[model samples]
Target: MNYLCLAGPTASGKTAASLAIAQALAERGRPVEIVSVDSALVYRGMDIGTAKPGAAERAAVPHHLIDIIEPSEAYSAARFVGDAERLIAEIGARGALPLLVGGTMLYFKALFEGLDAMPAADRAVRAALEAQCERDGLHALYRELQRVDPVTAKRLQPGDQQRIQRALEVYRVSGQPISSFHTEKPARELPPLISLEPADRAWLHQRIEARFHQMLEDGLVDEVRRLEARGDLDADMPSMRCVGYRQTWEALVEDDLSELPERGIAATRQLAKRQITWLRGMPQRQVIACDAPDALARAVECALRLVA
Candidate 1:
């Protein structure tokens, strides 16, 4: 069975390109289904900020693994891999090509390259770390991490409490540095991959800024407000930790609405930078310029060639 993985940074036109490829293939009497590879898109009520395909779009082309979980719950790369593997099999059984599309490079990596062997999350250790963070602040834990695993500490930001806690938890559970577990491991077999990005960095940045403002205009704050009013979600949840949602949640809580757009855009750009860095390390992917006028046509051609 042939598979197509379309990956790129957020707002790089991966969805439209994938939809076009699916449509073109359908015209050729070949059915294609999209299995979203995005982490943020999995949460319910995270529509606008996640850039989830609208109802009309989803109706036009089938999508899987989206809106499969509530915001109050946690979803992990392991869960994503399990869901994607099952979906791939189902799509294959139906004789349709499976197209994995999104900006979540970690999910793509876990799906294709497999994950590191790591211990499960120890709730007791995590709670202890959380308590330590609340009492002594995140910097103290970061300092402790520096003493134990300087490599991971240097790589993570001092304010990254979630990761800092996890790294510490890993150490507490396994008596080994988390970084050591990141060494190369056996991987699952995958099909052809096409990575898309704008050739002009400036253009992509502009698009990021513009799209953020557009999201604001499209009621992103209101969406966050609705999520907050639900009383079941909180800022610390993984779903709420998404780039724009996090900034917007803080802005709403701190009553600093004016800085919301700027902060959200900045955070999104940082996310894109990290995503691009990951994409750069992926081997054997056909990279395409998403900003090209004929990008969709080029993508369809690439998909056809891959499956042929």
Candidate 2:
């Protein structure tokens, strides 16, 4: 296994299990470096809300692709694939294992399944589309996408602004249906995937709630305030749209910290649910019940066995 992946829903113990796996590999004289698959972790100064690996943990084990961008910037699946490929090669050249870890399933999908040679994003075209959306509503643009590229439209919701706009932009820019470009993508080798999930839903929910409250106790609100004070980021940015950050930003916008706990916890649970759904769609993943007493040990064994 040239590449090993450890993925799970939020608060499902993925971080602890990944650290243990890396340590176990190191003890066996096989160094492993983690490459974050998370979109949120790529941004700097968004730590507490992201449950990012602490300074000590990162110092203990080399981590890649974290804090690589500013909150005002955008990180896409294509960019992630490019960065991960480079890091995986470099890490392997150093004779260490590259462990892909995080809850960003779309990155994993793009890396393992291969991204189609779609047209690069055209900012000018996209801006025009955004203006049109503002004037005519998202439904009007979605309807236009349906007319231009129904195959892509069928897979998207009427309100999926990013994808809807992209599909339209592709057609308008390249005179081709975006879906037509996906007809013949070269397949990629599927990496060994280990997924940590809980057997008890309520147990996972409790963990999510507890962790959100702990993030608050750890000054996540202060973190958000600092980011907001920077004046360059907003709620619509990908960084602020993160589960915890989004809820905290809304609370701050409303000047109401009291409702943050409920809103943040609820949003985190919803994120976990979406992650689990994505994990289930990947048939190659090996599942481990994360709430088990021996989960970490089992995860280490599984990882070591795969990387051996």
Candidate 2 clashes between residue pairs 3 or more apart in a chain or in different chains: none
lDDT of each: 0.89, 0.91
Q: Model 2: which ten-residue window has the lowest total lDDT?
A: 182-191
> Which candidate number has the best lDDT?
2
lDDT for each residue of candidate 2 in 1-308, tens digit (9 for 90 to 100): 67799999999998889899999999999999999999999999989999999999999899999999999999989999999999999999999999999999889989988787888777678778878988999999988888989899999978667679889989999999999998665756788999999999999999999999999999999999999999998776778889999999989999999999999998898889879989999988999999999999889989888887
Per-residue lDDT of model 1, residues 111-157, tens digit only: 87888888888867887887899899999999999998999999998
lDDT accuracy of residue 184 in candidate 1: 74
Off by over 4 Å in 2: 119-149, 156-178
The C-alpha local distance difference test score for the whole of candidate 2 amounts to 0.91
RMSD values for the candidates in order, in angstroms, are 2.5, 2.9
lDDT of 1 at 83: 94
